[model samples]
Target: MASSSTNLNAQSKFDVFLSFRGEDTRTGFTSHVVEALRRKQIQFFIDDEELQRGEEISPALLNAIETSDISIIIFSKNYASSTWCLDELVRILDCKKRNGQIVVPVFYKVDPSDVRKQMGSFGEAFVHHERNFPGEVRVQKWRDSLIQASNISGFHDSRSFRNDAELVEKIAEDISKKLEDLADPPNFDGYVGFNSQIERIKSLLCLELDDVRIVGIWGMGGIGKTAIAEAVFHQISSREYSNHFDGKCFMRNVREESRKMGALYVRDEAISRVLGESNLKIGTLTINSYIWKRLRRSKVLIVLDDVDDNFIQELESLVGQLNLYGPGSRIIITTRNRGVLGVNSIVYKVKGLEHDKACELFCRKALSRKNRSDDLLELSKKVACYADGNPLALEVLGSSLRQKSKEQWYNKLHDLTLISEPRIYKVLKISYDELSPKHRKIFLDIACFFKGEQVDNVTRIQDKPTSLRYELEFLADKSLITISYKRLQMHDLLQEMGQTIVREESEEPGKRSRLWDHEDVYDVLTKNKVRINLFDIIFLSIHP
Candidate 1:
């Protein structure tokens, strides 16, 4: 039972917030529930007279309700009589609506239908309130709150449960299961060749150190940096850190959020999430102060995913300005560019999956089963080889060939080999060509100027008529481009393809729409080329 509770990995200030009528069930049913929660070592908050004596729910009690991951509302005979209990109910319901708090109504000797319809004792309590409070809006609100809460599926005394002790154990078990589910790390279902990388990164993290550690996971796009980081983060979060940190873990797609909102918004959200402070608003002046003040002494695990070169400066500035985090804090950053990581930061370069792992992944994707099919094994190996251990390519190719006949598979494999460019590029082009013109433009822009650039910065660069957010999401869904850490990310192969497309627009370099080659730009400029049809040109000058 103790092991069961520990296994839940539920990240919340309180495991459960017990809402009940003290006079009715405090020493009886509620007391038994409290003892069960205590034996399990679950963190819970049950308001006592000291906290509930005021006319209104105390700020402390309200905070507790908001922070708790789950609320167990005991619907007893006299539950509605206490205005304080009714107020707490309203707050719990509000938290459920706004914060995704889980509410469980335990009908202890009260009928579920009576509670929902406000009949019998529930009706009597409301009637008394109507007479004493005299048609106040507060009474009506409580009634509505009760009706809504009762509709939610929870423990019912008469129908679903009978014995009180048995019910208490069931509730504890159910809560434990919910916590376990919440604490369960991101499913790497069908994930392959990631355990070794996770171990390597974990060793680099050096969790034993008391100092803040910022480790960088760097690789080309589609190399599984994000996946690897996610696995490691969740493993650390659910296993080792749960006991020490009490659920203080924050993982954000920094590129995605930074692009969709802004860098500041991402910064604000990170602080808010780690500190368990929701809807936390901070300006440029106060954001840094707030972050440092809140996080300076707190040990936390933070993962900033999909960082890029363009956003690196902003991140650096933010880190410096905020002076983020206390000692023992660990920040994991996943980026395509190695330059994005600071000099002192430990960097782990994510590599492609091994041949065997790649083959297994391919077979799983293409055959819809992990076990190698005798008929498709040879073709699967060929496809895996073409994928070059790239998980994304394997997935795309495998999915493309799924449920196809052997003859069709052979024809597709032959066609795949005939492509002059890299196999991965050819495979990615399918997704690229599927995009609308607007989405295509967005993908091309990201491949060129906006890759790893913040969303706000990318929006500033585009002269488009419509919002690129939708187009960006479309590209991401198609796997042509990815939005991580709020920045646009493209695989090296896709980037190459985009560049190749621009180059193929015209035979002469000067006639191309975009020119990144320094020699071509120099020839276009210094030689005064006649057909300079370029819309964008990047010139790089190196000093030796």
Candidate 2:
């Protein structure tokens, strides 16, 4: 299950929020709907009578409406008559506009047109309120809220169903089904060559057993450890199994976060997310027994991605090892070093894509052309095999050769002879540093300025059209770039490296080789920054 803090810190407290006039349907239709939703095991919020007594919406009710993933408004004939219900509708629509909350307006025993146009009972209610309320603006706002809510496509109780029981059941089931999207499961579709590893990892997890298990997945950088863990997490935690773990957390890029922040913060964040709580003040000096008791009682699934030897001990030192979690709990730790998890830990080693699988994966990314000639297919197979089945290398090199001519393919293959299969993490940087001075200049220009420009337009803008193509050819040969769909495309790593190089060229933006950031360009043009460096910028192009 996804925690409340999954997306943008939006803490979702309830799956559904029910808004209705208590006096009209509290004992009849709303009761049946609540019972049906309970039978489906859906969490919802239905306002009590105390909430309806106030002229303004209560803070608790407002919070409930704000935190709910979906709002179901029972628009009975007398729904608009209650000022409290009108306020709730306005807030519900406001939430829908602010964050993508789902709103279902059920028109019960009322004409849709009447609610939309503020006619019939809706209009009568508004007229009476407009006269009774001191301020006319509030009443008008309610009228506008009704028109907007009624315009949305939702359940029509009278026309869509035979009776109230059937309609209530349908509503509960539909809402329950819609809540599945909130889980945001990792998608394996369109991904090739991952089934064998995913299945093996699942079998190692041993979720069927009653004992707790700690599985460590270790591989070289860029070997698909994170992808495999994510797929396994989605498969086991999915709603298909009723016995899924009570709590689950996937902490991504733990190494990166530890470098940027501190290890203590990262450890605290992992614990809070796994327990589905916020503001966990678990100090290192004094650990609470209550926290340990709760951890020992609840089943948890945690993925500590990219951790080191010291960090594992840092966590176990506080949580009391496997004894902290309940039986049947599973913790998956991914790292580049297998020794980090200590000797008795169950470990899985991930190898790169095999021969045939590597070729198939490479062809999927590289060759989109339907009419593939024999020579092109042969060259592609040779290049993929040259990558030694390393997924990162194959993808980087394959993408570089996409949508190019036969002669260009031969030249790219020849360039591969100049370099061996380098390590995956430094592949982009090593390729860029090896380029000729002119090639590097052209590459940076495209990276900083014309990323998505047409080939013809870029050449036309350059000083020498013929020489520009030569530089582009070498860059593509090094697998730093690829042209596809009539557009020049460079990898994201290349762009970041180029920008960093230019940034370090000089402190002053105007004196730098390129200007991509808008604020820097504006300051250069408007503020007249004095260039203190003796060197002049070789090329200047604003980011397009």
Candidate 3:
């Protein structure tokens, strides 16, 4: 993807659109703002066409307004006098409402109240227009546009600035900061250790195939599932053979964003990106039916990143029956829970990086350079080994250990033996935190006591509920537990993380949720300790 691709919005062709009375500020304040924008490499457009009497706003000008991310309207005394400027104002306001375009109004020696009410100089202009063209069809629309634009919060040119240059600098700097915050995609410049995984997924994608395929990248949290999907998405966007799709959209952080901003927001986000429409509100129409009709005509490649099991039903409505999608359309979903995709969907399970690649990645992050110090080389390898090839763990630990003394590195590695690092634990905990209470108990039980136990034996425990198998399968679906050869298994880090969580619940074993160590279990049971309110009865494994 291009460097500017990160700044993509609904129809963002220009960063700034300058709409003003050319006669008022073109040579002075407007030119300075444009110069400042040019210095900062801010893309912008300004119309220079001379307006003839009763002429309409140029299509080129309207398109520029719609495409621009931000519009700066300079409200001057004579700004309302020209029908041309009024027409541009009306279009800019329309874009603001329709495309979510940002609008900045510069009250250049004109009162905002006057602009809103069309008073004083504004009144004079309207009076002249009324006398010239009685009962003008668009006169009320121009007044409404002025009112709407004036109501928005923007810079007021008054005693607030030292001079016009200061004002121009302030406005330009403010807009630069805004553009920086608008939709910068995840940075992968220093991203490492996932090239092969990306390649494997791409081969599975089989871009040459003409069928509409759904591919699921399934893995535990922080295993680089989203990273791999993002790489494939960008490749399909730019690659020669795969670039035949009519539209492309990468809907990132689907799980997190849907939780943060309602599911409707995510649904609409996917629609506008894949459909290439601006600020499309699905409420006005039968949206699923509308999508069903619109998607059948054009092939589109879309990635729903970091999806959860709960979001799959919404995904069905969003894409609307996979076969109905236009030919060659490919949909990729990244998830921690494979069951969310069902038994039939093609799933690629993502594993950790190999040891050598893991070491290389850790060294790069820890040293902040490609080269490594001879003294730290062995220590780096040791730290990487502790990370167990998990990319997120390596990144968090490596960056945290950057520039630390050799003794500190040893202490850090020693700390890893006893507990999961808090930062790494926080990320891996999200999957656990999202689980149902019953499933969470099942997960902790496996982590603490039942890991590697035969599935039938664990399920046959006298006190265990009949739903144990259901909960086990649920945990397996979430990748928190594994079923292999009739035995349950779990990742070393996740197991340790669960134990750490239990320990933190209370210092006393009797009060904690689960007891793993033999001495702790014996002490609690033999002492006849009363269980805490949180757990009515202390649960422990009855394995021989």
**C-alpha TM-scores of all predictions:** 0.55, 0.58, 0.49
Error of 1 at 179 (Å): 5.4
Clashing pairs in 2: none
Model 1: per-residue lDDT, tens digit, 86-160? Answer: 999999999999989999999988888898898999899888899999969998899999899889988876346
Residues 1-61, model 3: lDDT tens digits: 1112223244446788887887888887777877767655567876654434347765656
**By lDDT: ranked, best first:** 3, 2, 1
Residues 1-544, candidate 2, lDDT per residue (tens digit)?
A: 2212112122337778889988889999988888766654566777655533555765666788898899999999899888888988999999999998999888888898898888988889888897898686878888888889888878854667989988887787678668876755554422458799889988897888877788889987656787788888777877786556766778776764564456677777767766645546565734578877888888988888878765765556534367778898888888888777755468999888887888877776678759477778788888776666666667766666677678877876776656665444344454466567877888888877666667877898668989888777767655677674356776444566778889989988888866766567668868877442221222233221
Give residue 416's lDDT in candidate 2 (0 to 100).
68
> What do the candidate models score in CA lDDT, each in turn?
0.72, 0.73, 0.74
TM-score of 2: 0.58
Q: How does model 3 fare in lDDT?
A: 0.74
Q: Residue 75, candidate 2: how far off, in angstroms?
A: 9.1
* C-alpha lDDT of residue 62 in model 1: 74
Task: Count clashing residue pairs per candidate.
Answer: 13, 0, 0
Q: For candidate 1, report its TM-score.
A: 0.55
True-structure RMSD, every candidate: 13.0, 12.1, 18.3
